[model samples]
Target: MKVNGKVIVVTGAGSGMGRALSLQLIKEGARVAGIDINEEGLRETRDLTGKASAAMSTHVVDITDRERVEALPAELIALHGAVDGIINNAGIIQPFVPIKDLAYDRIERIFNINLYGTLYMVKSFLPALLERPEAHIVNISSMGGFIPFPGQSFYGASKAAVKLLTEGLYAELKDSNVKVTVVHPGAVNTNITKNSNVEMRSDVSAEEQASMTLSAEKAAEIILNGMKADKYRVMVGKDARFLDLFYRFSPKRAVDFITKKMAQMAKAS
Candidate 1:
């Protein structure tokens, strides 16, 4: 569905891809209700909107809070008059450690924010979306959701859950006006580690880091284009696209490749 003149609710709108998505949505003539847990970050996002600030509203919301999430649809509709689309863009990565060394609290936190958070948003706003003439739901999964990255196993598992959940929603809502799209983004230059409260140590040179990751702005553009076309699956970055094909062709080989890469990264660090 075209975003022009629609009201879109974007989670994680404080910074990174979410902020970029909010800005781009407003540029496309859509009103945005930006949700994030950080009040300062939300304020920064609102400030960055410039003249388009009027087209956006910032909400400091923690999507993992079920009650708060459930209250969003009503609040957003009251503010925007109607809700049309939702982008579940808020998520976190687990600590760069093996699952055996990972704590239960960390695992729960990752799943809570990444998986259950998406679920709550879907359930809360799906009714509102259904009432609209046309609506869309976009969930941000990761390339790790499909391909294995040794240290990020749990993070990948949570995103993989998001992948299936989004696909399942698509199947169930196929005949309805509500559309669903699942996105798999390869490494993007963002503050996800800081946001997730996980410190990352890497020995990779700065040049290599720049080459591997896509910019947040470009990632948002790709996502919006996919949404406009109502695509069922959207893969961001060349890395994600290549792996989507590669993993499908040879899952074991893809896994082995990632295992080796992660090993090298660990050794370097």
Candidate 2:
């Protein structure tokens, strides 16, 4: 869980928290193998990690491809001689609309990448991970996974699966050296909406949206620190932390809060 000198595989290290996490890990002396669907994004992440074509670096790979993910452990092991950790961070939040209005194809794509992608990464690397005396798994869920949002039902569902999956892994690995952590992040200042096929409920103003509810760097810092502590659930921002409390203490109130937030957005638009 210590970032320094850890051989970590990070999926979807193209942008957002994934990118920031990769940079943070490398800075802390971790040897990172970064993967992303966006090769351009990977390049940017590589630049952030270090300006070198070193043994531990970034590459372009789609997580949704089962065959590729299956072969990943071998590839990584061949290069690094071991796999110490895996970050199942590849995800998509497309078709950000009501379930009824969302297209089936988009839903499938979202789940395939968000849920299945995470599963495949874990399945492919678990056996290898078991061999290591101490290993770790970091999954990135969303605030939507724990709370509800009007226009992102499918996204929420996919991440909720990851959240549960992470917890289950934690329970199973309790006595083992393999650590599992799921991170729930609030509105981060990432271009997720622009990059994703998801339709926003309301277009954020240029300034406000640009400002980001949370900075990716800050979120990444918190996540790495949480992993070091072997935290079960990491809420990246105040909003994420607060909603988690509401979900536990007053589930109905959280729903009401979401409903009201949606209504306000509708009125504002």
Candidate 3:
């Protein structure tokens, strides 16, 4: 679906890739409704958009709250007159610990934000999206969704659920006007660690961080391009593409490789 002139909703729009997506979509002549729990971050995003900020609306709503999520379409319609697409980009990571040491409450929080939050947005907006002549839904998964990282078991599981949920949506909505796309992103330079309030398993040096991660802006560009092409699967960054292919051909080898690397990182930490 072409983003030009469309009214799109993006969650986690306060920071990271979501902020980038909002800015980029506005640049492409699309009106965007940015949703985030952080009012300050949303203001910052709006400030950063300059004159293009007129095409954007910032909403401070928590996606995990079903009532608020359900009511978002009406609020957005009042502002933009119509809704064309949604990007479920709000997600958080769990503490860097083995599953055995993970708390049930923490696991629930991760699933609530990562999986159920996406579900709430999709379900809430599906009716509005279906009404559009052409609509798109983009859900951001992760490399951990497919290739498990040792200390991120629950987070990976949550995203794995998102991956399957998005794929199922695509299958069910294939003949409909709505298009669904799931994204798998490799490590990206974002404030996810700070936002999620989790300690990194490895104290990554600045150089290592830069080398391993894609910029949020670059990831946003790749994602927007994929959505414009109506691609069902969008993998951001070379690492995401390579690991996806590697896991497809050799699941066991991929798992073993990542496990070893994660084990070493954990030991170092």
Candidate 4:
């Protein structure tokens, strides 16, 4: 779908990929409503945009809150007069822990934000989206979803749910104007790790992490192009593409390799 002049709502629009995408969309001529639980981050995103008024709006919201999620379209509609698309990007990664040892609260919190949050946003805006002759929904999954790493099982599970959910939407909406796209990104340079209690086993030094990771701007560009192309599954970054293939070629071998590498890294560190 053409982004120009489109009415778009982006969840998690406060920072990282969401913020970058919101800025890009505004540059491309789309009216944007940026939503996030972090009001300060939302304000920061607003400040980055070129125009103070054009295609720019922000809201503070928790996607896990069903009532609040449902209210988004009504609120945006009240202001913009219509809705055109939804980008379900808000997600959370829990701390590194084996599933058996993982805290119930941590696991639940991850799902609430990553999985159910996307679902709620999709359901809330889909009715309005379908009314348009052409509409779009973009859901952000992760490379972890395609292949679960040992310590980050919960995060993988939540994103795995998103992968399936987006695929299912595409299947169901094949006859309709609505298009669904899922993005899988690997190790992007974002505050995602700092925001969560999650730890990395890769022995990646802070500086190394800074250098190797993809920027949020590049990630946004990949997703934007994928959405425009109506791609059902979009993979971003070299690492993400590699994981996608490695997992498919040999799941056990790939998992075992990651386990051994992470363990070796932790021991050496």
TM, every model: 0.98, 0.94, 0.97, 0.95
| TM-score ranking, high to low | 1, 3, 4, 2
Error of 2 at 179 (Å): 0.5
Residue-by-residue lDDT tens digits, candidate 3, 1-269: 99999999999999999999999999999999999999999999999999887999999998999999999999899878999999999999988889999999999999999999999999999999999999999999999898898879999999999999999999999999999999999989999998999876567787888788899999999999999999999999888898999999999999998888877877787
Report the poorest 10 consecutive residues by lDDT, candidate 3: 198-207
Per-residue lDDT of model 4, residues 1-269, tens digit only:
98988888999898999999999888888889998999999998998885545568888999999999898888899999888888988887887668999889888999999999999999999998999879999999999888878778999999999999999999999889999999999889888875565665665687887789999999999999998888888999999998788889999988888888767766776
Per-residue lDDT of 191 in model 4: 81
Clash-forming residue pairs, model 3:
none
Assess each prediction's global lDDT (C-alpha) against the native.
Answer: 0.95, 0.85, 0.94, 0.88
Instruction: Give one digit per residue, the lDDT tens place, for model 2 in 176-197.
Output: 9899999998878876776685
Q: List ranges where model 4 is wrong by over 4 Å.
A: 199-206
Looking at candidate 2, the ten consecutive residues that score lowest on lDDT are 48-57
Candidate scoring better on TM-score of 1 and 3 = 1
Best by lDDT: 1
* Pairs with steric clashes in candidate 2: 94-198, 95-198, 96-198, 96-199
Question: lDDT order of candidates, best first?
Answer: 1, 3, 4, 2
